[model samples]
Target: MIHTHEVVNQPPPREGVDEFATDAPLVEAVARWGRAGAVPPLSEVGVHVGSAAFQRDAELANTHPPVLRSHDRWGVRVDEVEYDDAYHRILGAAVGAGAHTSAWADPGAGANVDRAAAFLLFAQVEPGHACPVSMTHAAVPVLELAASGLRDEWMPRLLSRAYEPELGGVGLETRPGAAPRPAQGGGRPRVAKRSALVGMAMTEKQGGSDVRANTTRAEPTGADDARGREFRLTGHKWFCSAPMSDAFLVLAQAQGGLSCFFVPRVLPDGSRNVFRIQRLKDKLGNRSNASSEVEFEGTTAWLVGEEGRGVAAIVQMVTRTRLDCVIGTAAGMRQSVAEAAWHVRHRSAFGSLLVDQPAMAAVVADLALESEAATVTAMRLARAYDDDADDAERAFRRLATAVSKFWICKRGPEHAYEALECLGGNGYTEAFPLARRYREQPLLAIWEGSGNVIALDVLRVLDREPDAFDAFFDVVGEAAGGHAAFDLALAEAQSIVREVSADAAGAPVRARELAERLALLLQASLLVQHSPAAVADAFARSRLEGDGGTLYGALPPGVDTAAILARA
Candidate 1:
């Protein structure tokens, strides 16, 4: 008798792939350029992130998005966002692995690269919680610019590996003498927790990226004690992410100008600050995290730096977060490629495995190429951050960060879509990871800055920082002599940079084109210098030599499909 309900031709679940080991590109990239001793920790974290339990948590977190509790039953205005246990677990795991504070905890050669690798690995498990993690990591540098007293008090807490989620409930007023204060003999103020997470409140209703148009005001509270100058912030923030964070880096108009302030959830008196989470955004993605509209009515804050220098003070944090965006996108791409490749290798169609089919092989190889390029570029940027003493590296990063941010992020959604297609119907369903990956891919491009905003930032660097522009070309130029295709691409990129620099007024019109070319050239150059010969040859021939088409799977003949898929 024939079986009526046979599950025929279905591939087994793509489990047990060592996320670090199988990711030849990421593993090789880290080992080659990242810190010499960083692999063991990274490998351990990679194993955890790729485990079945972690993947299940990722699915549960996204499936059960955070719920906003604007008020208690008695209308107490609690404004607490409640997330599922999975969210907390994943976040705790990430924190425990030092994804947030590793660089600060161990400041040495390749420290940033190690941190970046950890971040990329953790983000592969879940992207939502990475928001606060990224912000908290980035906030350390900005917080350093604060008064010495404030820095001393907060740095230890921020660098702690512990993950604390307790929130001092609203309306539970703190008794006057209960809150921490300086010791009787004028010692530093005490902190309440072992670890703390930082969030960001920027971009208002009227002004998106035009932060200069912000109308929120910060009024000095007359107190001049050593605990740092007190201020009462009164304004509405249109986009405040991770509202439950211990403190936030907010921007507000001060007497001097727009300045950065550290606003806490609970005031020094142990009473809840006047931070009102108006409403949580129903975003397209990043559901595991909370992004809210917040109101600050006399909320207590401390100036991070001199008033009117908010932009300068927060620029470094923004740069760091932008790097996370690049890494996040690269991580998503890597997952997509791995999933797609696994499916094709195991699942058969007609008389052969999908991976053996010419059409399917081409698609998987193309995706692998994109993912490898993105990984290399992102890791290179991280390596640049590691060597702060090198002015040329610093300058190169200044320009390349913006360039990679624009191109890599913009390519994520398309790459994810192509990879998802390789699985056909299974990839389109929520049961498969690709559907979620597809949704999460766009957030990176839209988060820190939109595509155009990032491209313009690249242009701004070229026009203002001549050294940075030259530094960018210098790095890309090193790989010029190796490949003719790269040589041609580099020459064209230089020409465009010159043309755009000469005509600042017309630069905006060609910003995206220029950014794309520069990004492609940079990726090609890096691949030429570091990637496997097959991978580098394919990237150069397709991306650099104009042999590619608008769609994926357009890699020309003669490409090493098996070698590329093996890496994937």
Candidate 2:
């Protein structure tokens, strides 16, 4: 065999490094907010996620994608979605690491922080599987609020670390083409030992964000059992991610008004529910996960919370999912900056190494600043979710979650693009990771709620929950005088808040602006409090003071790019 040319000046593959220990910002944030003992386990997760084998699996999962099998060869209605084996392994690793339910299962000091760190590590490697993972994690709170029987039956299965992709005996009707009886489990149902995942189906074709506009109707089954009020759902869900999940938190119209329901794929009687997959959506990214449009024909469902309180019940799930969106976005940013830094350190141009070059260093350092800010902010939010959180902490999360979701997710695509450009043509190709990241970044912004939806939600918090708004300001106020640039930015953000508070009607027009300023102030505050002096200083001058230009690499002249790049 003759080689066409010996490859030279190309950077080596970036893998096998411990993602957790090497991450200074994540480590510092975790120690400050999360339990000190959590670091050892998180380090183990870092090893697996950063390994070459895991990275290969991630690549294979996306490349093969998932196939929807609506029926078997015998023409029997199967309604199954087949996935690549790599996908299963990836999910298995994540679940085994307690990334899904550690917070709820082992509640203690900084439980959410530990789980969030583990989630960030895994998601940095493969984000497609994170959807099902995120949904399952968010499902705990909603299930807790459910009837005792429902919670008791499902919590054990959900909290299990074992990952079983198959529905197994959890499907409906052994008799071929027989109708499914929604619920008929006598006393305590025989639950499986396998781990279970939850999904969400809220948006319909007619109404996207407006769940009240949903036309799906829930008819009473006239059975008031241990699992709360039983109802039959007959409707079409426009977008249902992870169709193979064990159950879904669905929204439909009840006698009172729009309400939330827990719809399981398999009835308690060991038969499949009437869950039909219309078709899998062809999305721009997140191909490894199956997102489908489903139709429920007399589907068995148990009501969660109360009548006419669907939005209120599901808001808990939405809130957690939105937090994951911020964490996921931060993870992607971390991957981007890390990959860019790794590339520049090895590759050379014009007889000089890329990292040693001023221009390349500035760009990578700028990317690092964004990643650090995001990581710190995400960990702080996770801290708020801890079981020991006081009223002030709870209040802070209510408003801060929306702010971070709107800004960090909005910054994801642009951040990925800049990082992709660092590797020239290599980053643009599917053979590399950045191409996938570019596509993956946008989904976080769209998931849970889009930019406008989140912005308005922030305004709603300000208008309705005065305590939450006050809590947010108090948390950010800790770093008010830490830096001159940050102080000015904080003052300006407060002014904007006052103006928005004064004119509620005009607030809608300034919602985006308000969200941006709040997000920036939050990030800057976290950085000033926790991050190194150089990183915080650069961020304040570049982002808050408007000293930087529109694109990346626009740091101020005196900023310490070396110190920032050191972390990268």
Candidate 3:
């Protein structure tokens, strides 16, 4: 129920941090949301902030235990706590704030070499706390240094070992040849990013980014531009990561394999190489960041990894980005919640304090609960990333990433909106933080990976030979077998998944929904079959990034995505 209609906005008190503030529409709106009488739901503002399913997931996320307050140590505000630990650690922790994993390097991170084997095996320890951006920047030193140290003969091959961190934000901005540039720019300053991003990720496009169904092709070329060079890139690249990159990692189906061709720019020796960015996309959230719809008509290229290994290679790159997005999403949510909560504590309304209101109190509590839940899921996934993580554990890590991403991305805004209502008319205004939070929430689901993708990852676990699944759950079941009811529920949930899978008659539509349900049941089964205290305890220990996907450059066990040659 929206309260905007009943409450008119009141400007903020122009004094301190509220010094440059304006209306208090959000505070009044939330006050009205809790009040007895209600007017009409505002035409423009509507959020299913009251969704039970959503709220439930959020509640679970916050159940994890708290970690050492790393914010002060890391220099991040309270809002960015979830992303403080490389990849999935902070994410899983945010889900339930418990244990962690130790998976934050690629094949060549500057970590100790002898530790490489141990790093691969150390499923219980993760990288030191660092932001997603830092994590991504990490590869820079490793790759660049490796590239730099080369005897000038093997530089090209070393890029094969280079681990590029994919930072996927709706509108991520940065300038060319710059690192962590500025935060505020000269022109339109709303993006709040100083770096004029050279490579912006415009995630909104074609089939909404379904990699499997992607049609953008890179066929072999037979001609040259004004000045000649024999190379191939014969299709439109809908979403090129670095359209402006001097060299783009283009994924295309070649004669023999699905390959990533590192298309190098024609050296100005009268050579022709143009990845003409038809037009840059105009996105909603990360506006200052640029993403383009590119036409790679006859571009030049060279293969990076093996041919037909395109899908696997892309997945490798995607996996890196996927974790980064989770970290970034958590950071965004953290920012919104902190800002609104801080405002609520100081403001007064209806002759009492903002935090004092029963309505306000309940909503804030709910918001905190969601943040906590997301934190745990993310951390668990990070820890499970080591090279030695068994197949079952790895599947859980994938499922964990999806669960954390889906839940937080879905719920973060709900908290912001509720907090906005608490702020009243002022919150609705651009002057306050709630409105920005409101606009930013949609990007989380849409970015990194979408709700559908994450859900499917979870469903894949159940669909695997049930025993393979049980192989992991067996451990839990053995330890927790003392609880009769819990065991029964788990068995029953497995039955449900089997029943659903059996009935799926090769239909995509039915299969998708069923997959989501299978995952939902598994998650719910955890609740019924286990004691809340135990679940919470297990969750709290997941604050580290030492889980399944932690190993640098290795697939979790049984990820039998072994390349089957794609026939032409």
Best by TM-score: 2
Which predicted model would earn the best lDDT?
2
| Model 3 residue 508 distance off true place after TM-score fit, in angstroms | 5.9
Using Cα atoms with residue i matched to residue i, what is each candidate's TM-score against the true structure? 0.95, 0.95, 0.54
Candidate 1 residue-wise lDDT at 146: 88
Rank list by TM-score: 2, 1, 3
After superposition, candidate 1 runs with Cα above 4 Å error: 168-191
Tens-place lDDT per residue, model 3, 330-356, is 444444445556666677788876666
Between candidates 1 and 3, the TM-score winner: 1
Between candidates 2 and 3, name the one with more favorable lDDT.
Answer: 2
lDDT of each: 0.86, 0.91, 0.39
281-362: candidate 2 lDDT, tens digit per residue: 9999998999999999899999999989999999999999999999999999999999999999999999999999999999
Candidates 1 and 2 compared: the better one by lDDT is: 2
The residue-level lDDT of candidate 2 at 59 comes to: 99
lDDT of 1 by residue, 1-568 (tens): 7898988788887665568777887887888777787788887888888888889999999999988887666555656788999999999988988889888888877788888888988887689999999999999999999888778767887898998786532223345666554322222233456678889998999999999999999999988565578899998999998998888999999999999998878665545667898888898888888899999988889998889999999897999999999999999998898888888888998999999999999999999999999999998998888745399999999989998999999999999999998889999999998998898999999988999999989888887898998898999989978888889888888888889988989999999999999899899999999988899999999997764467888887899988888788
Look at candidate 1 and tell me the lDDT of residue 415: 95
All candidates: CA RMSD (Å)? 4.1, 3.9, 18.1
